[model samples]
Target: MPDVRYVTQGTRAAIRRTTREDGAEFVRLARESAAFHRPWLTLPTTERAYLHYIGQLEREDREGFLVCVRETGDIAGFININNIVRGAFQCGSIGYGAFPPAAGQGYMSEGLGLVLRHAFGPLGLHRVEVNIQPGNKVSIGLVKRHGFRLEGFSPDFLYIEGAWRDHERWAMTSDMLDQRTGAG
Candidate 1:
């Protein structure tokens, strides 16, 4: 059994750390949602790859969380904070994917709010950045809904699928979140 650790909770969903036991279900979801992902993102769809994915997250610079529906405890999506930098930076890049069943349901929005709170609170992060392919409107909208501001654009920023893809950078700071919530 996976040692499920709840990272944070929201009204309709909860964020929890990914676990080794999640491999099977995670891979199944990734495989089933392949069409939904396609050129946008690539996820671990095999057991071996899943294990490697988990191992990568175990590194100090990365953290992965599963967004699960509160009512049913079913995974709605996944979010990862990658390339964490402390000291003067105190920042990390974010990557996320919503499963087919959970897409367009607003669950990811609620779950992302929980993640922001975790990032600013326990994680002590100052800023979080997300890079999205320009053609992926859904992903851009998701970040916009969460108060991420457009930073800039990068040509051939990240290699996805088979070739290099252009991306738009979006970011949010802890101070910005506090301001939005009237806490700062």
Candidate 2:
């Protein structure tokens, strides 16, 4: 049975805020998906580490959501909107990961679309940005499909896996999303 507490629902997937209860399952998925996530991500795969990871998400500036398969209620991925800035700049940075059995099944795509809606609607965010490693073509394609514009390139933008990495900055504003969906 699908969880009735979905924050947003799509055709094949639903997203809900990630909680402490998700740690064990998330760790299992992460550990199992290690090969799929290497170089691009370094998620917690142990229970203790997972709890610590979850703790950081319990902040005013962060929103963590799990993308669940609507049919089986299996966790397909996770999306997080971080560094929320209110006041003059209503923006957030989005990061996500798609796990095994759901990586290439379009579930994450559908889930991401729902997340964008939630971000613009209830979250009241005007702009959202994704900074991805330059070599990560799959991630780049995902943002492109979602109508995020290629902003610029940032060299040594983020430190990952003990080294500075180059990143391509992609961004989408509420207006851009509106225009894409012909809702503007």
Candidate 3:
């Protein structure tokens, strides 16, 4: 069982760490939202696969979170901080997926904002990067709305759905987040 930490509470949703108990609901949501995540993500839709996925996230370098509806506690989306690096370079790469019922509901936006806060605050991460495929306008827009700046582009940056895919690198530093929120 993974430790659960509440990141933030929003008007319609709350962001919190993913737990083993969420396996059934998470797999159901992933299966139902397959069309919405096809080219961009490959979420686990089966019980065994879901457990394996969560186990991987339990590793030291990765963190997983879920965005849930405040009123119902239903999962709306998920966010992951992967490849964390400490020491002088305190950073991580982020990936996310919004489920069908919550795809255009703005829950992801609220959840991502909370994730950023947690990442910069208790996590002590200095930077977070989101690598999006150029054609993924929705993903790009989400990061842009949160003030991520375009850092560069990578050819065949990652393997997705089989073939290597290109990606546009967008990043936000802790300093940038502080500047945006006027925290410091």
lDDT, ranked from best to worst:
2, 1, 3
Report lDDT (CA) for all predictions: 0.91, 0.93, 0.90
User: For residues 4-120, could you state the per-residue lDDT of candidate 2 as single tens digits?
Assistant: 879978899999999999988999999999889878988999999988888878989999999999878899999999999999899999999999989989999999899999999
Which TM-score value belongs to model 2? 0.97
Worst 10 residues of 2 by lDDT: 157-166
Per-model TM-score versus the true fold: 0.96, 0.97, 0.94
Q: For candidate 1, lDDT tens digit of each residue in 80-113? A: 9999999999999999999978888887888888
lDDT score for candidate 3 against the true structure = 0.90
Instruction: Provide the RMSD of all predictions against the true structure, rounded to 1 decimal.
Output: 2.0, 0.9, 2.7
What is the TM-score of candidate 3? 0.94
The model with the greater lDDT, 2 or 3, is 2
Number of the predicted model whose TM-score against the real structure is largest: 2
Off by over 4 Å in 3: 1-5
